[model samples]
Target: MKILSLPSSIGLASKIAKNIGCGVADYKLTRFPDNEIYTKIDTPLDGEDVVVIGNTNTDSDIMSYLFLLDAAKEQNPKRLIALMPYFGYARQHRVYNRG
Candidate 1:
């Protein structure tokens, strides 16, 4: 029963995963010389349960979530759980102030 914990930032999510005795996998990401971003996951994820941890404090984090979701799907994991400590813009629940 192995868990693949992937995080966007090491400061928040990784710290929690570490405390819980879970192994962290690095999803290699960097900005190129031309200011273009690149990312790659070099972990063995065959038939493993993958949990993606990320924050939605910024728009880029949402994009990163999409990327991680797609990667998890491609890896064909047994199960995928998305843990978002900070979820994005769900603050627009009001409709025309119809209270």
Candidate 2:
């Protein structure tokens, strides 16, 4: 079975992978001087199970996650699981304190 994992940094994802004994496929993200973001999955992911782990630290994090999800779908993974530990805009659950 193939497993694809995308983590924000080397600390968390790598540690978890080692603990669980799962092969980790690293995903790279590059930003240009023009402020454009580029992302890539480093391993063959066709027909594999994908798990994306990311914590929300900036506005771009959410966009990055969405991009990864779309890419994962395109890869035709047997299953897609997005494991986001911290979500930033989650506080926008409802409208309150109307002025």
Candidate 3:
């Protein structure tokens, strides 16, 4: 099993990795001048279990998480798990003024 820690969840992911005795996968994330996200997984994940840790605090963070998820899916890991510590939109669960 491997943990892919996003910038926002590094500390938590590191703690989890320590307790689980697993290593963190190497990855890079960057933004293009056009405000697009690019993600690259440096570690090989063929037939490996992977856990992605991220917190959705802002629009950029959400986009990064989505990009990460898509990239991880392309790698064809044996299993993929998403750990979202903080979901910023959880409070919008209800639509009170629906007609």
Query: lDDT for every model?
Result: 0.66, 0.70, 0.91
lDDT (0-100) at residue 82 of candidate 3? 92
Ranking by lDDT: 3, 2, 1
Q: Which stretches of candidate 3 lie over 4 Å from their true place?
A: 95-99
Q: Which ten residues in a row have the lowest lDDT in candidate 3?
A: 90-99
Query: Number of clashing pairs, model 2?
Result: 0
| Cα lDDT over the full model 1 | 0.66
Candidate 1 on 67-96: residue-level lDDT in tens?
767776687878887877777776767586
The all-Cα superposition gives candidate 3 an RMSD in Å to the true structure of 1.6
Put down candidate 3 lDDT per residue, 1-99, tens digits, no spaces: 989978999999999999999999999998899979999999888898999999999988989999998898899999999999998788877897886
User: Candidate 2 versus the native: TM-score?
Assistant: 0.77
Better of 1 and 2 by TM-score: 2
Q: Against the hidden reference, what TM-scores do the models get?
A: 0.72, 0.77, 0.92
Which one wins by TM-score: 2 or 3?
3
Question: What is residue 25's positional error in candidate 3, in angstroms?
Answer: 0.7
